[model samples]
Target chain A: MARKALIENDALIDRLSATFREVGYEGASLALLSEATGLKKASLYHRFPGGKEQMGLEVLQEAGRWLGNHVLKPLAGEGTPRERIAAMTSELDSFYQGGRQACLLNLLSSPIGEESPFKATIRQMFEAFVEALASVIAEAGCTPAVARDRAEHGVALIQGSLVLARGLGTTKPFRKTLDVLADELLADLEARA
Target chain B: MARKALIENDALIDRLSATFREVGYEGASLALLSEATGLKKASLYHRFPGGKEQMGLEVLQEAGRWLGNHVLKPLAGEGTPRERIAAMTSELDSFYQGGRQACLLNLLSSPIGEESPFKATIRQMFEAFVEALASVIAEAGCTPAVARDRAEHGVALIQGSLVLARGLGTTKPFRKTLDVLADELLADLEARA
Candidate 1:
């Protein structure tokens, strides 16, 4: 019985993440979450008694961890700068396309006209992303300050590309923008070389 | 009487554009818009018989024109490349801060879950932005391809900065990012020099 409950908890988290990615926090109501998870409202309440806020926080933290391990870590690994950047860009494209989702940070941060408990968590996630990327760029031969700037630029590119992709209603531009940004960053490194 | 009606129509467009900038298209309902404009729903409907979609399209078009004239035109004007870039960056910061809003293109493009007329208009607005920025970069002594790339980068910076600002709940970083981007773009041009 305990094992079954764990499995159900995992399922609920996955479903809640997907729904939040699609509709944002305020937009995702208990009714919608219940329908998406194939669980009744009462059952969802049983798992997340704090309700949608609790679910949203869990989903965001999970996403942050996953993105850190999958996207940022690999890029910060030991590799030639060019290879590392290519890997990072490829990973981003795959994650976005495979998930068929926009950036969770952007969705969560949008001015939905209310204060969300998730905002601070989302901001911290981005700060971590910038720090991780900065470390990688510094390894690639940029000065610490330059690496920080490059990392900020890269984050801006990805975040903006997601907005563009969402606006264009297609992922092609998003993928293309990432590719372009990767090339630009690598070229800047080469010039320093 | 006709002149008075024309003035009222213009005011409605301005109010609607302001409202859209504050809240995204999906979140900005007719009720909110009516409240923002201090006009009843009946007056709003009288002005925009086709309802939110029609009003949204007009707001988008008006905002697009404002961006082109106020933001893009000055940057593309005759000045030293460094001067022109600085001017453009300052203009963008002021425009965004003055409105206390995110880019309308981004707001319109974000999903309310799929196919909608606003999508096409947003795409058109982006293309216009790209073209205008490209022209300026081209004028600043870059190859056409490089100019296009720079233009796209500029758009990405602006859009991403807004997201960052919203996430952090402050406009300072947004303004700072644009300043950094302008400096980067100028540095690239100087390297070529």
Candidate 2:
């Protein structure tokens, strides 16, 4: 019974996250959230005592955890730097569903207050992502500074491609960027070879 | 008096656009919009008879006009491809206010319906932007296809950097990307030289 409850909770979060992604924070009204999750307002309140803000915070937390597991952990796993990045890109393709979805981070960030706890959560998530990618690039024999630079650039490319994909109504830009990411991040190592 | 009214109208749109940039579409409630424009709700409705949707449409149209004049027109101006791009980059730097501003295109696109009139407006704006950049790149010795690809990539870089800047509360990524943009877009020309 405990295991079933945990699974149900996970499904609920996924539904809530999907609604947030589709309509953004301001658009995700109580009516819509309840509709999406098939839960009454009172039940949702029971689950997330602080309401939508708490739900958003939990969604961001889950996203960070997802990235850590799917992206950062693999970057630290056993493989060449290029291989690790390539592997990670495939997972990103899955995470983004091949660029059909806009990023929740980009969508949700604009509505929150400057002092909102979400800001720190998001910044830390990007920082950790960059750090993990930097370490992998460093393993490719670039200096720490260069690796850091490449990592930041890689993150920007990924984020930017999603924006383009949405604006232009095509996934070509995102898919093409991913194809080149491994090489772009490890150009120094490639040049040596 | 007529000129004064026109100027005030422009300023009003600017205020509305800034509000959209800050909080996005769903977040830009009637109360908030009234606050941002310093107009009563009825006055806003008087100006934008279609209400928030109309205001959002006008904001997008104004943005496209601004981009055409500031970015595309300059790209087609009589200067070397590299010089044109540099000047345009400077304009962009000011337009984005040194990356302290989040992009309205990225922020405003999320909440509107998929079939929203705003989608076509946004897509056309980006397409025009990419086409202008591609022309400049082709003038810098890249083939037509290559120019288009580079242009798309360049747009992604700029858009992505803004996302990073907003999330990290730092303009370094945006500034760094702009600094390298001319060279990155004109590498083929430089290589020939």
Each model's backbone clash number:
0, 0
TM-score of 2: 0.94
Model 2, span A1-193: residue lDDT tens: 3433322878899999999988788888999999998888888998999999999999998999899899999999987788899989999998887787778788777432366658888888888988999999988897999888888889999999999988888988999899989987887495544
Give, for candidate 2 chain B, the lowest lDDT window spanning 10 residues.
B1-10
Top candidate (DockQ): 2
lDDT of 1 by residue, B1-193 (tens): 4434533667889889878777666678889998988888887888889999889899988887787887677776777667777777788777777225777786666463567778778877777777777776676677888877677767777788778777766665576677676665554565554
Off by over 4 Å in 1: A2-11, A26-35, A40-43, A80-85, A98-100, A110-114, A180-193, B1-11, B75-77, B80-85, B98-100, B182-193
Tens digit per residue, CA lDDT, model 1, A154-185: 78778887776676566655766776766666
Residue B6 of model 1, lDDT score? 32
Q: Candidate 1, overall lDDT?
A: 0.74
Global Cα lDDT for candidate 2: 0.86
| Residue-by-residue lDDT tens digits, candidate 2, B1-193 | 3333322788999999989888888788999989888888998987899999999999999999999899999999988898899989999999998888888788767433377668888889989999999998998786899999889899999999889888877888889889988987887485554
Give the distance in Å from residue A181's predicted Cα in candidate 1 to where it truly belongs.
Answer: 3.9
**lDDT of all predictions:** 0.74, 0.86
